[model samples]
Target: MKIETQCLHEGYEPGNGEPRALPIYQSTTFTYDSTEHIGKLFDLAAEGHMYSRISNPTVDCVERKIAALEGGVGALLTSSGQAATLIAVLNICSAGDHIIASSSIYGGTFNLLDVTLRRYGIECSFIDPENGDAAIEALFRANTKLVFGETIANPAITVFDIERFAKLAHRNGVPLVVDNTFATPVLCRPFEFGADIVIHSTTKYMDGHAVQIGGVIVDSGNFCWTAERFPGLTEPDSSYHGVAYTRDFGRAAYITKARVQLMRDLGASPTAMGAFLLNLGLETLPLRMERHCANAERIAAYLSTHQKVEFVKYPKLPGNAYYERAMKYLPLGASGVIAFSIRGGRERAVRFMDALTLASNVVHVADIRTCVLHPASATHRQMTDAQLEAAGITPGLIRLSVGLEHIDDILADIAQALEQA
Candidate 1:
């Protein structure tokens, strides 16, 4: 099926007598015929729902759809984007392992890797991804188990070099994990560019209405997990009755381990209601993304010529640094995100944001309604000036998430706000 058709028809195709829409299986547990049946599920010898904590029918449908969208073997949904990142990393990396990640990423994820994950004994190196391949390789060590980057980084709007990073990770005997929240599969499928794993904050474009907060991790099932390299997947798991993941699950080892091990232990599974809402968003994703990219292009063009705007960063804009790379990977469009700096710095940025009429001021992005945020003051407030610079977040930078509204109205709102500033 085409992507648009897959959005609506991939995961759950109701039978002749079944409900048309995906039903919400809201129960916490499922029934079985006998003790032997339930025991087989517990022993990992059978396939069926056992508990909502590990899996649920409602959430599974969403997961399967996302997996199909990204061309992956399987997907696992989590409570939030943060939970998704945590489990994706811990599934492979242990306490003594290391990770090489691009410095340009969401602030919440930055904190997770730089501060929180470090305390757990996993060391991380933040590199400038624009640097040449040799420079990136310099940061890798023998114990480095994975590499990470965002498709289109938050706040900065820098487009990542997925193929470059993927090759670097593969050469070092690791898999490349990309956060594809900004440029969803409609714009770019990272798997085609060699990304081994794809992740998303489903709270963003996948849940465009902002009605749900969830995340998902999709494994491409292309990377090799050999016994000599990844003992965790290839060797026996004494915790689960000595069952080896790679031996039993084949290409699905990563996702299976992530579900039964991390999710079962952390209990970060999405709520049934949340999954239902997310599925609704996914159904309209292709339509919404078309408008999002179109509006973003027009808005970026308007901001580029604005007197009060100091700079604008949108990959679709011709003069932007990532324009060429974006054309290669995001030919359809680069989603709705745009970042610009106000002329008067942070104070003026704040003034302009407060004066907006049609646009909103919120701590969120990728919503159905246009909204703006100041990274220095809100999302990246916890980072120091040096850290902020490393992440490509300037004090005057204003991250604008353009919506499906008419381009004229959106520009008028920005124009009036600029006059107020």
Candidate 2:
């Protein structure tokens, strides 16, 4: 089936008397017939849910749906987008291990890598995505376990060159992990371009209604953990009774490890109710994405010609740096988010945001209602001046998350805001 069809029908199949809609299996634990059967689950000798922290029926259905949507072998849903990033790295990386990440990413993720994870003895090297191959490769050391970047960076809206990053990572015997939150699977599937693992904050576009907070990590199942570089997977796992993940699980070594080991300990599993809402959102992702792209393209065009606008950064627009890459990766449409600078800097930018009557000034993005945010003041305030500059968030830059509203109304609101600026 095509992607559109998969979005609606791939995950769950109901029998004769079963309900058509995915039901919420909200219980924290599942029952078993015998003590021996339960023992097998705890030993990892068999696959059956014993606790919600590890897995749930409703959440599994959504995970399967997303796995199909992104063309991955398996996926694991987490409590939030941040949790997915943390587990994705921790599954392979240990306290002494390191990661190479693009500087252009969500501010929250930056803090997590730079501060919180560092405290745990996991160090991260931040590099500019625009820095050519040599600079990126230089950051990789023997301790480097993963290469991390976003498919389409949040707030910055710059597109990462996946193929180049993937090649660099593969050469160094590390898997490329991409945050595919902004450019949902409908826009770009990173696995097609050699990405080993794809992660998403389903709280954004996948939920679409801004109702739930959830994240997911999808394994392409292409990275070989038995490769000489990764001794962790090939070696016996003492926690799992000397079972070597690669030997037992084969292609699903990464995700299986994340579930049985990381999720078991960290306990960042999503609620079954949240997964049910996410499933409903996924059903309409293809249609909503088409409208989002169309609306974003129209708004970007209008901003480009506006008198108060200094520049607009959207891959769909011609003359943008990422247009070619976007064409290759996101041929369908770039995404809903767009970044632009208002002519007069910080004060004018704030005024423009305040002047808007139709678009909301909200903390979220990728929702049915159009929303705007000033990263320097709102989201990226935790970062210092240098950090803000590195993330491509200027004092005057404003991020507009285009919604599915009528094109004329959206354009009119933006036009008025520009006039006020």
lDDT leader: 1
Model 1 ranges with Cα > 4 A deviation: none
Give TM-scores for every candidate, taking all chains together and pairing residue i with residue i.
0.99, 0.98
Per-residue lDDT tens digits for candidate 2, residues 122-190, read 999999999988888889998899999999998888899999999999999899999999889999999
User: Which candidate leads in TM-score?
Assistant: 1
Query: What ranges in model 2 sit over 4 Å off?
Result: 226-229
Q: Which pairs of residues have clashing backbones in candidate 1?
A: none
For all the candidates, what are their Cα RMSDs to the real structure? Answer: 0.8, 1.0
Model 2, position 330, has a per-residue lDDT of 94
lDDT of 1 by residue, 9-117 (tens): 9889899999999999999999999999998887788999999999999999999999999999999999999999999999999898999888989999999999999
Query: Alpha carbon lDDT of residue 253, candidate 1?
Result: 95
Count of steric clashes across candidates, in order: 0, 0
